[model samples]
Target: MKKVIGWSLGIYLVFGLFIAWYLFLGANTDIPAQLKGSPADPQTFMNERELLLSEEYSKIKNLLFFLSVPFEWLIYTLVLVIGISAKFRDWSKVSAKFSILQTAIYLFWLSLLVEVLSFPLSWISYNVSKTYNITVQSTQSWMKDLLIDFWVNYALMILIVGVLFWLIRRNEKRWWFHAWLLSIPFSMFLMFVQPVIIDPLYNDFFPLTNKELETKILEMADRADIPADHVFEVNMSEKTNSLNAYVTGIGSNSRIVLWDTTLQRLNENEILFIMAHEMGHYVMKHIYIGIAGYLVLTLVGLFIISKFMSFMIRKWGHIFKISSVKDIAVLPVFLLLISVLSFVSDPVSNAVSRHQEKSADLYALEMTDDNKAAVSSFQELSKAGLSQVNPPFLVKIFRYGHPTMLERITYTNEFEKSEE
Candidate 1:
């Protein structure tokens, strides 16, 4: 009993570190050209460097992400199988082989369960979109797109599981070592292919044609002493009414994208604030900080994964469709560990984001004098976007990128008070 617990704990810690090491440390970490600037905006330059570095790192992380899906199914199944089996017999006496068999069954069953769960939701989402007049495509086209999405995802799942399980069965002794090494190149391939390949399948994106809006935006960028790049508007309104704006790409392709909804709804003041917030993410280097933090966490996690994976294999390795501790199937455990880590680290992520948002709000306040209009912008967001005034704490923690409507209103009012 003591041995089992020790083994599980040990496996969790070491495997976690092993996973982290490759994701956070082994990936490329280069600086992007856009992020490079003079001393005036050192933050932008630093962020660019981190973003470029992450291009290499992201490849690793994406591969690890794909690798982890089956692993999690394995973990989920193993826990259920082992927990159920332990109810009937002395856990210490159960053969590793028998435990592995039960886990395989568990994995297959869970996959079926997931397919069932996903199908209904997917159908409902499409139906809802049509009801809202958000989708113009016919039902046949939607179904075809859904089918394509499913097959793409299903293929990836099969590949990850097949490779991970095969490796684990082949090398029960040194799986983590090989898995980490292999992930580096697999990650690179994914990065090279993703933007050009994967994303285009789902949505239409084209260059922006609004010359006046583009000119105004560029003028603002110049006034702020920030780089002026191309601006693009995505045909996002074709599918959904939700509003979003982002600054994407790195070198020559670096551009800003505003959703059609955003362009249609916002006045000049509101647009300026939205721009400031997006620019804040760039100027303050949030993306770089986020990537760096991810890399650091991954390195630490991989180190832990390497140290403790064997114990996990001995106990429930069968659940993951692998018999050896060295197998990459244990990547799921690393994910669970990171999820736990993220829960613990939520406050930190939120704090940094909130501070950046506040700074951007300040920037917006300085740029515009229409305080009531600024406050009204948020009110318009709530009303049009159907955002809640106040959300539950748990929901806020999990979902919100910005403060709640109530919080924003309070902040805006306070800012106005301070001005008077």
Candidate 2:
């Protein structure tokens, strides 16, 4: 017990110190004198006040972002070390007549505890966004969304937990393989239903209201062979000032969703470039590829998790107050391992995503043949989102899924110059 506690404290210190070092001292923020005058210049993308606000806002956000992963691990480690999970496991015995219900009860309490413990960070994040005028959502709306998210996440996780324990009981050695097999279709089903079903719970979505703009987008979709029958737009300006567009779902239910904020903030040409970028994802089959990659990662992750979890339980089950692989109390250990693995693998995932996004950017350029619009659109996105055009290397590796704003703009500008 002393050893476990010491190890947990050691990890927390190392993670916290590393995040502090990279965040404060790793990257220079200076903009080159020549680049200072350009719209894509991170330092000059906004007015004086906006620039100041963006700098302060990005700093707070970066601190929160870097801390979030290890913070979760900390929570799980604390929960495990304190025997709270064992309490949850024993408390759920009242529902043991129904094993499924017992499993659900244990998971619900465990997840709820995590959320309650983590709410302060969520509140800090919300207040920061609100202070910077990034989000316009009120306290009531934000809390409502929080509840919705909790329930949605709980619903999915309960299903996963039930399958996991059932597999362990049936065949402890093969559970990981069987669980991985089950996750593939389960993942696909969620993707298929997300845009059509899950998304509407949070925001309204309908065919784009500006008929003329919608027509142009639909035509672009046709040219790209995306088979998108309608362009969808969500009422996002009510909650956020961020400009965005995205591709969501798959097959017949697939959608090209634009934030109404995007339409309000950008010109038709810029909107076309944004929409074309989304269409590029569809044309390139990035969605299918992403799904395949997720499955492969899960397969490997589950295998490793299963082995490590069993070993931890076998070696320290007494210390953990966990009796067996089938004990629900072992979950925190499982979660801790998963979190660490994800943090380690995050850079590789980000690199792959950046490559995909870069490809989508070039595809949009080819489809639109408008370098000016492409470059300007990325600049506008950075300005509106108050994003650092070139964040620190570690920050970019962990948090950014797309190329840096400067990288995208430079690539687009270079493409134009090459053509000329």
Candidate 3:
């Protein structure tokens, strides 16, 4: 046990120091010339006030983002300690007497504990968003959404944990492989139903009422080789003032959705640029590619968990009151391993997403042939969402799924320059 603890501490310390150095000292922070515009130009995309607000907003948000990682690790560690000390093993044994009811109770309590521990951070995040004028949802509405999120998450956790443990009990050695196989179908199922079942639970969705804008978007979609059909508008104004458009689902369940705020806020040309970018994602099959990437990552993550979990359990099972991998009390330990792995692998994930986004940006430029619109659209998006035009390189590597606003704008300018 001491050896295992020593190994874990050593690895964490080395990794933590390396990450800190990479983020603060080693990463590039340069902005390309194409992205820099003269203040003397009358058509400077971002005004002085916008740039100042964006810088301040990014600083606050980035600080919170970095701080939350350690806070979450501490919270999860505390939960594991408390769960073990609180007789979770005895509780699991008693609950098993009632069949699967024990799994349900154990998961419910565990989830509730995590939620309670996490609520303060969540509250602070919401308040910060409000303070920055990013969100418009009232306190009551936000709380309602939080409650809804909890129950939905609990329900899903119950299903996943129940099935996962059943697999482990059936085949202790290869359960990880089987679990990975099962996750593929489960992920697809969630993707298929989310647009209809899950999303509507939080916000209203309806066919876009603006016939003129709908027609324009459909025309743009047609140019991008996406099927022409209805465009859905979500009532995001009820919750947020930020503008966004997205493509969701797969095959027949697939649809393009625009926020009502985007429709109300952006000009037709800017909206066209945004729609084209989303269509680029669909036409390029990014969603399918993203799913494939997830499949690979999950397989690798599960394999790692399988290899180490047993050794750890053998060494400290008594201390944790967990006797086997099949015990529900081990869930927190499993989650802790997963959380650590996910953080370690975030750079790979973010890099892939950034590549896809960059491709989409280029596709939008080609499809729209409106460099000005494309650049202006990103400028508007950054201003409205309070995005940093020049995010630190470490933030870009770890947190950014798309190129920074400046990067996108610079790419557009470079593309135009090449053509000229």
Candidate 4:
């Protein structure tokens, strides 16, 4: 018990120090003179209305941001308690005599319970987005999506739990390492199929209808040495008013995707810049980099879970009604550990994403040699998405996957200045 507690504390401290050091002393890009402004004052770059809207949006989002972590932890803990207190293990035994099937059944029920408990939070989020005029989806559509998500999640939980327990049963001593090995190919397989299979299940995707713009985007792709073939457009406006574009898949499946909202809201030059930015992600191999990072993190996370899971089960097994680490009822406890690790390590992951995004921004500027277009595109994006120009430091550290609007705009300004 003491050893487990000590290791837990050590992990927390190490991650905490890493986050602090990275945020405070890491190699951050400099904010250019032209883009610097007090948060209290409206910048000349954005109109007064736009600035006011951005501030209001920032306040709402920041509140949600701060509330989400604790709220999620609380909900997860509650579910764990409820599942254990309810003697889900007994129910699982009655439902299925086979251990693997019992585990799967228990996992599915627990997952469904979590989803039901968490639905209120999801509903609130949607309501808030609607209040801010960000979301365009109707209640019926939203509910439909939620239903789809629940079933999909339930199916996935069963499969994952079944495989995980199988691995544990197969290799009691080295299950974590084996699970990590299995995850590599599984992750790759998901990436390969996601664009072609999973994505289409959620939203409608079509080839870009604008022949002229498609030609222009392909030309830009050609210039970046990315394969020129097709650009896909997703009907995101059906759900949200926000603008977005991305590069997804790998090898033969690789493609550029744009939101229909982005096409409608941004000009030709701005869209070009956005496409260029996504192209940067492809050309820089950020996808592979991200996959490599996930592989390492997964290995470490699984190892940590293995180290302390036995101790945790021994200490609380009677109280929680869980017999052992391999019990179906222990799934929630396993999920709890992984979730805690993920929450603590979020800043590191976000920092890596921000770094990639910054690199992509720079690549876009160089590829197009159009600083004004890049800056304007970012401005439009920030406005459309209601993004904070300069968010609080903690928010930036914890939540931001890309640099704030202020940072990107300033970076472009500096790029232009350096050219001069």
Best by lDDT: 2
Q: What is the C-alpha RMSD of each candidate to the true structure, in Å?
A: 14.7, 1.9, 3.6, 5.6
Instruction: Kindly give the stretch of ten consecutive residues in candidate 2 with the minimal lDDT sum.
Output: 36-45
lDDT of each: 0.56, 0.86, 0.80, 0.78
Off by over 4 Å in 1: 1-75, 78-116, 121-197, 304-309, 318-321, 327-351, 416-420
lDDT of each residue in 1-420, candidate 4, tens digit only:
345445555655565555445434552433445545622123655687877776667666656555555555555555544454246667788888887677766766676777776777688888888988889899999998888887877777777778988888788779999999999988998889889988888899989999999999999888778876899999998899999998888778887899999999888988998998999999899999999999999999999998777887787776666667777667767888888899889999999999999999988888788888887887777878777776767778878999988878777866852364
The residue-level lDDT of candidate 2 at 256 comes to 90
Pairs of colliding residues, candidate 2: none
Candidate 3 pairs with clashing backbones: none
Off by more than 4 A, model 3: 1-35, 38-43, 83-86, 92-96, 417-420
Candidate 2 has a TM-score of 0.96
lDDT sort, best first: 2, 3, 4, 1
Candidate 1 vs candidate 2, TM-score winner: 2
Position 20, candidate 3: lDDT: 58
Native RMSD of candidate 3 (Å): 3.6
Residues 140-243 of candidate 3 have per-residue lDDT tens digits of 99999999999999899889988999999999999999999999999999999999999999999999998998888888887667885899999999889899
